[model samples]
Each structure stands twice: as structure tokens, then as C-alpha cells.
Target: MGSTTIGCDQRIAWLLTSARLLNPDPELARRDGFIKALADQGIKIDNSRISRWESGLHPVSGQVAATYEQALGLTEGSLVAVAAGLRRTFGNGPAPREGALRGADLTDGDMDRLLELIDEGKGTGAHWLRLVGQLGTYDRVYLRQQEWAALSARLVQELAVSVGVGFVRRYEAAAGLIRHPNAQRHLTRAIGGFVMNPDTQVVAPVLSLLTEIADEAAGDLVLRMLTSEDKNLRSAASSVAAVKVSRGHFGAHALPQLESHVVGSLRRGESLDGRLDSFDLAVQLPDESWERAMGGLRNRRAFDLVIGSRRGGELVPTQQTAAVVQRLSAAVQRDTPTHSPHENDAMLRRLLRESLLHAHKPRRHHAALLLAATPYAPAVAKHCQDLATHSNDLMAARALTVLMRVGHRMGRSRVLLQSLAETRPTIRARALVNLGLNPEPIKPAEADALLGHLDEHSRPVERHATMFALGMNGGTTLKKLAKSDTEWMARSATWWLDQGPALHDSDAALDQIGAQT
Candidate 1:
């Protein structure tokens, strides 16, 4: 409708102008005559005033915006919603007042609208897969009592035969959130079959969901799998029981290489945190009962315990360093003579430094994980500071997290902003989270990128990432986003605006959330 692509602030204004220009009845749609037509619809506004709005000089009231949509034969509130999204994104025009969306609670009408959307999308398997992420982010999803039984049954029917790892992950996330008894019954029946499925990928994720809705009878079913010879099934079951497996089926080949890399670095006395973060490197150490291979490593117990816990997924710096120091203190008290009380501490630092700049990504991931957990050393501090601007975005992002842990944020603000532009979604999402958690004011460029990145039509993973990024960045007008056509995004925005922002989004926490696949 316009000669050129409309920029950020021009969305609503462009929409209005195009509506008039493309109108079938030119006699009543142009500025002067449109005013008369609008006035007859009880929308009292002068022709010049309309021009000011269409020219992007000012904004109309929510009522007028809604009325304009209706008068232009557009859906009611369509313009108003776009205008709100535009203002929220660009800080353009004035903020909506009476028309602005408020609160997180869904009204009956909102719930009905949601059911309608679900009904429309239900034909496609993608719809059910999407709901896994969509419904997961909401503070709460309400279905009127009458809608629950049928909906849950339909969900169970879909879950029963769903294939593919992507579908499994979405279903796992969704199933974890569904605890209602009625849903649980159907889900249990469906999930039991998946757990016994031959494919490791199928059994692995389903096993996680099984424990969520698994009942006493299901326990007998799981019990037999516990003794099963299938390594993958045993590993998944072991995970459920909060026990360790000697060699887990998942990431089996990766672990020894990770542990071996770190051990080699330990022998050489160095490792860098940057190396650990790039490759999603996480390795579980043996419990004290089995004992760590390296007797001189004082941080072994801490290392084993951190990874041993049922919820422990990755190592965070603060916890690791604290545990290392505590072990060192205990060793000194016991007059232990294996080496300096801090020999293990020094060994850990050396391990990190040696691996920091390693060419291999897998080795780097291990070293970075270890580096974050262990105490900081001046030698590696410079490497992290330097790595914040490294060509490797992974290293750079990890450097940001490690530096922030040590109170080194002031010098890295520019690097922090650059991180927001990283091409990798994983690193970019991590940086956006870092940006949101940090207290820095949002700059116009950073703000624009954040806004532009948020599209309702974007993939659920990326869309939610941007939502948290923008909302957590602070001082955002979320009313429009809170009512987004994308239900999941809308629920996320509404939750953020109402309550989610105040919750802590620490680097470790964000890492966990952002790492969701």
C-alpha cells in the first residue's frame, strides 16, 4: 500500500493510510469525507486531526483506533492492537492509557478466544507440538471446567502416537505442566507405551514425563525397566530414581572425552571457562563412594556432589568456588599433607587456563564448566576479559557470564551490547537474558534490535526468548504484547508484565532456561 516498506513507528499509521487509499468507496474514505463517515459512526474527529495521526505526528485514542479499524472494514481492535505493539516496540507516539492491556488473569472471553484458536489449529500436528512451548510459559492456563475433559482427552490421543524428537521434547515440556487428574490418567496410559518403545530418543524424554504423571501401578511397569538390559532405558530409569549410571546412554561418547580433556588440563595445571561453555560440556563425576581418580584434586567432593544432585544440570561459578574454598579450609584443619591445602584449587585454575583457548570446542566446554565452578585466578581473569570480545561468540558469551560473576561488568558493557547481535540463537538468547538481568539502561539501537527480533510469527523458542529479553530489559510497555494474537507469547508477556519480571533471572538460571531445546 505504501511506496516503501514501513519502518517500526509507521506500522499503525501506514495501516491507516493504506486502509483509506485502498478503500473501495473513495467518496467516503478520504480524510474529509472519512471524517463525516466516522462522525456518523459517533467517532468525532476532524479531517486535519486524522491527517496528523496518518502522518505519524500523533496517535488516536484506543476507541478511535478501534473505530478506524471497523470503519475501514477491518477487524475490530486490529489497529488498536498494532498501534500498541508499535508503541511498545518503538516507543513511538504516546502510550495507550484506557485502551492499554492490564493484568495477567484471563477473562472468560479470553479463555473462549483461546479455545477457538486451539480448535482452528488442532487439525495440524504442529498445533499440538506448538502448544508444548506455548502453554509451558504461561503462569497458568485456564480452561473453563467444561472444556477440560475433552481437551485433555484430545491431548492424550495426540501424545499416544506422536513421533520425532522435536515432538517428544514439546510434549515432555507440556506433560510436565499437566497434573490434573483427568489428564494424568489418559497420559499415563499413553506414556507407558512410549517408555517401552525401542528407540532411545523416544524412551528418554517419555521417561521424564512418565515420572510426572506416573502412578503406583505405573511404578510396577517402570520397575521392570529398572532391571532391563537396555542401557538407555536403565539410564532413563536411573535418572528418575535420582541415581547414577556408570555410563549413561545419552552423551556417553562425549563424557569421557570431556573428562579426559579436563584431566589432561589438570595434569598440566590449567583450564579456561570459555572452553567449557561453547560445546554444552557437562560431565558427572563419581560419588565419594567410588572416589575421584585424581586424589590430589581437593574440589572433587564438591564436583561430585554438584553434578550428583537430581536437579544439578550444569555447574555455576559461585557454588563451585565456594565449595572449593570450603574443601581447602577443611584440608588445612586436618593437617592434610598430600600437598598445599590449595594445591587442588591451584590445579583447578591451571586446568581452566590450559583449556581456555583450546582449538577444540568439546574440550573448551569442559574447561569452561570447570573454570566457572572453581575459584577465579588473575591469570585466567585477563583471558576472560579479553575473550569478551573474542571472534568466537560462545567464548564471548561465556566470558560475559564468568566476568559478571566476579563483578567485572563495567568495562564489558559495549561487548555486552555486541553480544545482543550474535548470529547464533543460543548465544544471542543467552546475551539477551544477560541484558535483561543487568541493570543497564536500554539504548535505542539495542532497543530496536530487541523489538525487531520479537515477531509473533517467529518460532516459539525464539519468540519466547525475545519476549523475556525485551520484558526483562525493563521499562517496557507490554500491554500490546500481553494481548498478542500468539497465545503463548501473549500469556508470556502478560505474565511478565504482571509478575514474571520480578523473579530472579541469574546467569545460571537463564542458562538453564535458554538452553531449553
Candidate 2:
């Protein structure tokens, strides 16, 4: 068998005519307008040269073919493919028999069969490429037929598989073809399914696709995803927005809104769980990612919007990022009833040890608090005591509060006693409140000495802390402080007196004092 070939001149004529018809601007069909379009893409060819090619006096060259595709928004390689006889024409024309597959002809069973084949072919690059190529062809054919419903269903299924296998190119191709409103609806439905029962595998790719579309609806959806509680979804959404803004797909109108959302999330201390991975992916996006970020400043006069801009430097884990602390604390409290005594002791000790050493302050504090809140264990108690004796003021304060709440006797401890007399008012106040909240009995002299120290301080914050500490002691002092001269002090003292003595020894109590003052 021999291959049939189309003449280069005829192919160029067909492509040029199709480009002219598809162009919204009728003037683009003219030689002067076409020349300007080419110049817009930085291709400066003489006017006579373009006329020569269209008049069939000269054949199109590779450079001109590429520029034509770019200027006219034609698919990459379409003109060159036609010039090389690989394709017959452009503009939703009938595909060659080998690439032809109608959406109307495919059944649900047929779609399932293709998906099964794609599944079976996973991890084989060549096989996946072939399958995706076939799918792309089917997508184009269906798109031309306006069978959006059928094509959208097929695309959604293909996207699921493509994302699972990490076939990004295939996933992009499937997404790129989803330009129709019906197809967008189907993709939205698929996204909803993932939201209800999140599968991390599809989150990144699906978000990438949605942002690539970059329409208003997609932008709004991405915004909603940014605020999602699911860490994976929010992480994916952040990455997608970064990619879109970097590539300039994020429209100028929507850019401000996206920036505001990102800033708001950062302000709220929302943890982007997979942030490192997302940043790595953004950095890896073919040299254009950096170029795009820089180009925003160089050409577009826009700010360089990138992930690094959001995360100033270093991973400063806050309360939101301390998920491990929350998880281990819950497990420790719940597992005690089920596990053996030795096992529970070892488990809690291990968790507390790991948490105490964590780089983040919040996690360390949480671990110490969890240890204090759980049933008494000697190892846990020792860990909390050691942390309380540490030099870090915040850590020491949290550890001391935990120990006091759990009924640990701190009266004779040099660290706790010195902390009460510290020059820093906040530290002194915390130590005083912790001492007052001590479940063990305090001598009248010790309680009277603490109350007398409060009379020495004129600061409202000091006065507030004194009132809380006096309230915790449960006696005539609380009644006297409730009617003190300072209005805020009196109010806090009254509230504390009304509530009576309950174990109110945590950062929350300190925060309350600050708030009252």
C-alpha cells in the first residue's frame, strides 16, 4: 500500500482560508491585517512574502507556520501538520478514519470498556499515550458534533483515571477539551463527588484543570475550595491559583479577589497542609513559572505573585498546623480504657516526648497540656515538669499551667516561686494565677503574701491577674477585690466570685485577664 499526499500549496490555501473564516475580525483575512497579526506575535515578514504564500507562488515555511498558528489561536502544529500532509484541514472538519469516533456512537458500556483498558494500561507510558491520544481524538469529534453531554461524561471518567495515574499531559488534554458549558457542568459534578468523598489523588489535577479554564465560575469554585476544611482540597486550590496567576490565566479583574482571599486565609492562620509539595510543583512547572512570575513585574506591571510571597520564610507552625498534636492528644485520652496499663503508659510517654521536641511551639504546648489533662503518669508528669522549668517563657508558662491544673504541687519549686517575682508583669501574673489555681492547700500566710504583692502593682493587667488569683483562693479577698477601685478589676473580680472556685488554669484564663484589662 502507498500513502496519499496533499500538495503543500493546496494545504496552505485550505489552512489560510480556514484561519480567515474562524477569525472574528474580518479585517484579519486581508494581507495588511494578517501581516500586523504576524508582527503582533513578533514575526516580521515582508507584506509581499505573506501574499506570495497565499497566492501559491511560495510555500509556507516552518517559522511562518508556527507564527500563523499562534497569531490565529489555532492548535499547535495544525498548520505544519497540514503542510506536511499529516492532516487535511482545520476548523472542526471531519477527522481521518483512523481518528474518527463519534460521541453519539459510544454507549455507557463502551465508555466503561475504554476506562477499563486505560486502567489495564497504567504505568506503561506508551500505552497510556496511545489511549489518551485516542481519547483526545474522540473528544474533538464529539465537540464538533456538539454532543456535549456524552463527551462530558466520557471526559469525567477519563479525568478520574488520568489523575489517578499522574498522567498530567493526558489530564491536561482532557481538561483543555472541556470548553463547552455542558462539559463544564459535568466536570463540576465530578468535582462535587470528590468533595463529598475526597480522594486526594484527583484533587491536584482537578484543581489544575479548573484553574486552567479560568472562567468566572471556575474562579469562584477555586475561591470556595481555598476556604475548604479539607486540607488536601485547600492545598490543591492554592497551588492551582498560583499556577494560574503565574501563567497570566488569572484575569486582572479576578486577581484582586484571589489575592484578598489568600491574604485573608494567611491572616486567619489557615494551614495549607501540603504547602511544601505545592511549592515544589510550582517551582517545577517548566521554566515558564519563574519567567511568568518575573514577567508580571517586567511587562505587566503587576506584583510578582508566587507561593514564596505568601510564606515569608521558614515553616512557622501555628495552632492550625498542629494537627498531629490534636490527633495524638485525642488518641491518648480515648485509648487508655482499651489498652493495658504498661501499653498506655508507653504510648503516652512516646507521644509526649515526640510532641515536646517538635520544632513548633504550639505543638509542644499542646503535648504538655494533653499530658496534664490525661490521667497521672510519672513519665508524663516528669516531662511536663522539665518543660515547665525551661527558659522559654511561653513554654514554661503553658507547662506550669498544665501542672497546676493536674494538681501537681509547685509551692516549693524554685522555678515557680521565682516566676511569681519575675520583673516581666505577664510572667509574674501567670505564675501568681497558677499558684492560686493549685489544687493542693496553700497556707494562709502564702495566700496573704500573694494578695499583698497585688497591692504593690498599679498596672491594670497586674490588678486583673491578682483578682483572678484571689478569686481562685475562695475567701474574703475575692469579695474585697470584687469591690476594688479599678472598674475592670472589680468586674473581673465579680465574675470570678460569681463563678466560684473551679479549676480555671490555662492560657484561656490569661487571655481573659488580658481581655478584661
Candidate 3:
């Protein structure tokens, strides 16, 4: 590539002209006065050197350029960037079409012209791309300066257009340029101006970008957006939060708000139009559904029984509510073994057994989970084995997972090995993952056999499961999978390798699976 560097004489001439225009007093342009001014700012440049630079006899070095900027109150790096030809196109006159305006030199009219160009660029793909590039250039220079108020006003004007494609792209590009905290805060406030507006199609991207870059600082604003009465705004916020949280940023703090919004709506018997199910399930708070159910039954008889049996009170069977409470009670007891007396274990065992027989799939799944946590028994094992073979894919997967956990605890590898031979990839993947979780190591031959079952064409979800199993099992196969050209397989293997022995929670595991798909 040819060098873009300007000669020293050309750079010095531009610097002298810029310095003359920027200095408050015209006398500061003269050698003696300029030297005095540099001295005032603690710079010790000689009068002869200043005269030589203005006469184009020599170029100003970086040190002198910085000194001149400080002495004249110009934006830092503006002169040095000019001297080094870093921004060769920016001149003392109005900014060129493709160049940026120096922060100190930017004026209200200049901002207006930029906005006009952005407006004109809308709907034209190539023009919009070029404008976005120009906006990025301007942001690099002025985003950190006090010109935000003027820039923000221009942004607001652009956003007022019914279709805000140009302004949104500018917002994204500007956000990408922000490196300082103050710049981020300024941009966030600018974006926040549109949060209350009903133009979701335009506002969502801005809010999404803010949440991503601002971290917890944007949490309160996002929560408010999520709770807005406007369905569009709420949906937009939820979608933004889903992406942010799924990437492992902002999720921990924002989850309570999401759970309350979605799960709370569910508990109030309000239909979410299937929005609740569509949310990234990996981030769903564990036990959220059960907690909501328990909250609903707080005033009912079933609530009393689950909290603490209504001592001597007549236990009225409310049918459906009572059955749910029974399942929840078993789950709770299994979760808190020490709190529940030994006798309650027996009661929980019976409740889990009856729950397994219930026609409700959720009830059956919950029962299997609770059973997996309970003490081993021939009947419990039999129930798990039976459910593992059930025709329902979801229920069967849950059963097989519980069976693996129980078998691992009991040191019985037979069920796990049998599960590995299952034809369904989902089942086989789950079995492989659960088997890898067992403390006892699988023999090399068995592990190699399992690894050989996976191929480059395996479904993303299946590959995700296989990678985790291989990662946990420890083999050369994971390293090979990590090098696979398939994006999902490579990502999953890399994530598994990074996580090492630390277990992946349901959300993270689901996130890895979801991202590739």
C-alpha cells in the first residue's frame, strides 16, 4: 500500500492555519506571542521553531503538536492526528464529505448538514452504508466531546422520521465508537430519549445496543421498558434482554425483572399470546413455574398443607389444586431433606409415585425430577426405567435424565450404557452428557465408541451434547471436534473446553445449543 503520510511542510502549514483560527487572540499567531502563550501553558517551545513551522521550513513533531493543542485549548490528538496524516482529509475549512469534524470546530450548522445527508441516505442500501461509515468517522472524533447536546438534538430529529433506518444505523455506529464511560453515558441518554416513544421498530435496536454496552447501568431503564403498557415496547425489551442475557451479559441482574413480568403474568392467569414460551428458555429462572403456582395457592387450602399441614384442620380436597400442591410438596421435600423429618421421605416417595401416574405431562416430569433426588428404591428405579421408555419425547427425556442421575448415584452403569444405545439423538445425547457427569470414569474403549458415533453432519443440538460429553470425559476427540469447520460444533467444543470441569447450568447449556441453531 502506498504511504498516505503528508510531507512535514504540508502538515506544519495546516497546523499553523488551524492554530491561528483557534487561538482566542490574533496576536497568539505571531512567533513572540505564540511562544509566550506556550510558556504560559508550561511548554518551552522557542519562537524561532514556531516561525520555522509556519514558514513550512520543518514539520511539527508529535510533542510540539500536543503542546500546541494544550496551549490553544484544541481537542487532544486533533493536531497530532493532522501532523501524522492520520486524518489527512480534515482541513481548517468545512469538513469534507467523507472526513470528520474536529470536536472543537464542529458547529450547529455542520451537525445539521450531517443530519441532512443521513436523511437523504435512507432506503438506499449503498448510500446508507456509506453514511454509516461517515457517521462512524464523525463519532471517532466528537463522541467524547461536549458536542453531545448538539449531536443528540440532531439524532432526535433524524429519529422523528417515520422510518428511522438512517438514524438507527448512525446510533449503532456511534455506540460502537464509544470507549469512555462518559461517552457511553451521553449516548445512553440520547438513546433513552426514544424509549418512551411508540416507534418500537426504531427504538428496539437502540435499546438493545444500550443494554449490551452499558451493562447494569441500563438495567433500570430496560425494566421500565419491559413493564410499559405498550405491548410493542414490552416485547422489544424482552427480546433485547433475551439476547443480552443469553450472551452471559446483564442476565444475572435482569432475570428477576423478566421472570416477574412473564411468570407473574402467567400466575395471574393472563394469556401472553405464547410470548412466555417463546422467551429464551435457557435463562428462565429454575422452579419459576412451581414458584408461581405456589404463590397463586397462598390463600387456598392446598397452600396451608404445603406450608405446614393444617394441624387438626379438616383437609378439604380441592381436586386439581390439591394435586398440584401434592406434587410441589413432594418436590419441596426432596429439595430440603434435612428440614423434612424421616417420615416425610416416605410420604414424598408415595407422592412422587402417584405424581408419575398423573395424566399431566408437567406433573409426570416434575415427579421424575423429584424421584431422581429421592433415596434409591426398586420401585423408584422401575418407575424411572418405565418412564424412560415412554412414547412422549419430553417426558421420556426427563425420565432418562433422572434415571442417569440415579444410576450414577447408585453406581449402576447398565441403565446409562443402555441409554447410550437409544436410537433417538436427543436421548443418546442426554445419556452421554449425564454419563460424563458421573464421578466414575468410563473405559477408553467405551468412550471411543461413543465418540465414533458422532459425525460432522450431526444436528447442532446433538453435536452440542456430544461435545459436552467428550469435554467432560477427556479425550483427543474434543480437540478434533473443536477444529471442525462446522460453526456450532466448533463453538460448542470451544465452550466446553473453556468451561473445563465446571458444570454448565441449564441456561448456559441451552444457550450454546440455541446459538448454533
Task: Compare the candidates by TM-score and give the number of the best one.
Answer: 3
392-467 per-residue lDDT for model 3 (tens digits): 5544565555554344445347545654677776666666656665555556677567666777666544555555
**CA lDDT of each candidate?**
0.44, 0.45, 0.46
| lDDT agreement of model 2 with the native | 0.45
Better of 2 and 3 by TM-score: 3
What range of 10 consecutive residues in model 1 has the weakest lDDT sum?
A: 508-517
User: What are the clashing pairs of model 2?
Assistant: none
Tens-place lDDT per residue, model 2, 1-517, is 0011323353454455445533556556566777788778656768776666565444555345546656676544334333422121112233223111111234455445555644443222222233333444343333433344444444444444331112333443444345544356656655555543532223554555664465677667776777677665776677667656545565556644554444334333212221333442333233433444343332221122233323322122234324533444445444333212323333354335434433222223333433432233333344445556556554555445454433344343543464456655555655655555454444556656665666544554456456555555566666776687866557656765654553221221111110000
Per-residue lDDT over 412-504 for candidate 1, one digit per residue giving the tens place of the 0 to 100 score = 364456555566554565455445545555665666666676564544435544665556544554666667686765665675564323222
- Model 3 TM-score, 2 decimals: 0.32
Question: Which of the numbered candidates is closest to the native, going by highest lDDT?
Answer: 3
The better candidate by lDDT, 1 or 3, is: 3
Root-mean-square deviation of each candidate, in angstroms? 23.4, 28.0, 25.8
Q: Using alpha carbons, what is the TM-score of model 1?
A: 0.31
For each candidate, give its TM-score against the true structure.
Answer: 0.31, 0.30, 0.32
Model 1 misplaced regions, further than 4 Å: 1-348, 351-382, 392-408, 441-445, 454-462, 486-488, 502-517
